[model samples]
Target: MNLDRSIDDYLAHVRTERGYSEHTVAAYRSDLVDLAGFASGRGVEGVAGIDLALLRDWLWTATERGLARTTIARRAASARGWTAWLHRRGLIAADPGLRLKAPRAQRTLPRVVAERALADALAALADRAAGDDPVAVRDAAIAELLYASALRVSELVGLDLADVDRRRRTVRVTGKGSKERVVPYGAPAARALDRYLEVARPAILAGVAEHGKNAGGAAAPTAVFLGVRGGRLGVRSVHRQIAAMLSSIPGAGPSGPHALRHSAATHLLDGGADLRAVQEFLGHASLGTTQIYTHVSAERLKQSYRTAHPRA
Candidate 1:
């Protein structure tokens, strides 16, 4: 089969059968497409032509181009998975990627907003949301729930009306790998959600109807968050909103929804929440993934000690 066609087949298998998220599948596609182009330039026209040497050369070219270690590592992983799939299907006699290696990606601490700073920011958001402006109220709710539940932006946007249980103070979110989990929210988040649902959501949808869109008694949108055009709220919109809100706060690293997630997890860990419980709360499939917060906590403690302790 053509190399590009084979890559597409593998992508489809991962997306549908293996249940990889679109973001992951897209990354794999990018890596593989670059590999195909590199191979084609070397007169390699088929999967059979792929070999360990070519794979190594491709990685070397990436390194020479000054790609970050994380990018190079991800590309290597992508290539390994693709070649492994091909070998498993008997398309190749052996997996060339088995010996593939790349520089280890550096592990950086996730950005954690100071508790005071975050509280002040949320208070300001709440003040802005006290009015009947649909977007403002929705933004407040989004920010609250994002920090409260430590939701990924994708999971937050994917939430449907029925997924939320206000009385129970919980939401059912579909996380990565289509894993479903019910997570609880604190009263502050519950209040924000209640206000959004009671006032903002209806006003926004009503505006859509006034514009002659979603009219004629169409079925209501099920998404908990809605764009101005009355469709499900998109991931980009949420990112833009959160970025603008976090811009003024003094902090390093990304000022995105994930910062709130990282903050939530770190705060939970600092408060002495169990490591395993936090892993489940974040829907991390592995305990090791959640253990990073312990390092963040330790770093924070060291910073505090350095600043406050009296010594020679």
Candidate 2:
């Protein structure tokens, strides 16, 4: 088969069979395209002529060009995937990418909001938005639920009218792999959600007035969190709003939706939640991914012990 054909088919397999997301597949496609072009320049005609040396040369060239370690690693993974597929399909005798070493990347721990500070920030948000206005009510609910549930910004915004169970204090979240999980929210978030459903949603949705006045008085269907134009909440909108609101709040370091998620997991661990439970709560497929927070908690505990223990 041709070089392009081999690359395209391999990417398709990664996406469909490997269950990779579109963003991941797009990155893979781009990286492999670069590898293909570079291999061509090195007089490597196709999969038949590709070798480990060519892969190493491409990675070396990439590093020399000052690509970030993360990008270099991703590109290497893309090349490795392509080679493995080619070998598996009998298009090549061996996988050239098998022995490739990815550049080491510094793994930064996820940022988390401090317990006291996160409360103060939420309190401040409530204080400032406490007018009986609908927008105020909605903003209050948004902040409360974001922390209480640790929803990904996407899952938070994608919520529907029926998705929340106020009584149960949980929401049905459809996560990656279309895996559905019911995540619990705190009582404070429940109160805010109740208020929003009772009062704020109607104002945002603008039921009867906006849709040309239905004969039966029905309105245009709306998403749970309406944008200014009364549409579904988008990721950027949530980021911008959360950033603006939380920027001045102390201890909400480098804040975003993920900060709340990290905080939720860390706090859970602090309160003696199991690693497996946190993993399922965060929707992480691998337990190892959820294990990072243990390190975060360990740091906190060590600092506390040093400061509090009287080493007389």
Index of the highest-lDDT prediction: 1
- What lDDT does the true structure give each of the candidates? 0.94, 0.81
Count clashing residue pairs per candidate: 0, 0
Residue-level lDDT tens digits of model 2 in 166-201: 777889887765567899998888888888888777
TM-score of 1: 0.97
lDDT (Cα) of model 2: 0.81
Q: Mind giving the per-residue lDDT tens digits that candidate 1 earns over 1-312?
A: 679999999999999999999989999999999999999999998999999999999999999999999999999999999999999999999999999999999999999999999999999999999877899999999999999999999999989999999999999999999899999999999999999998999999899978966554444489999888788888999999989989999979999999999999999999999999999999999999999999999999999999999971
Tell me each candidate's TM-score.
0.97, 0.84
Ten-residue segment with the worst summed lDDT in candidate 1? 212-221
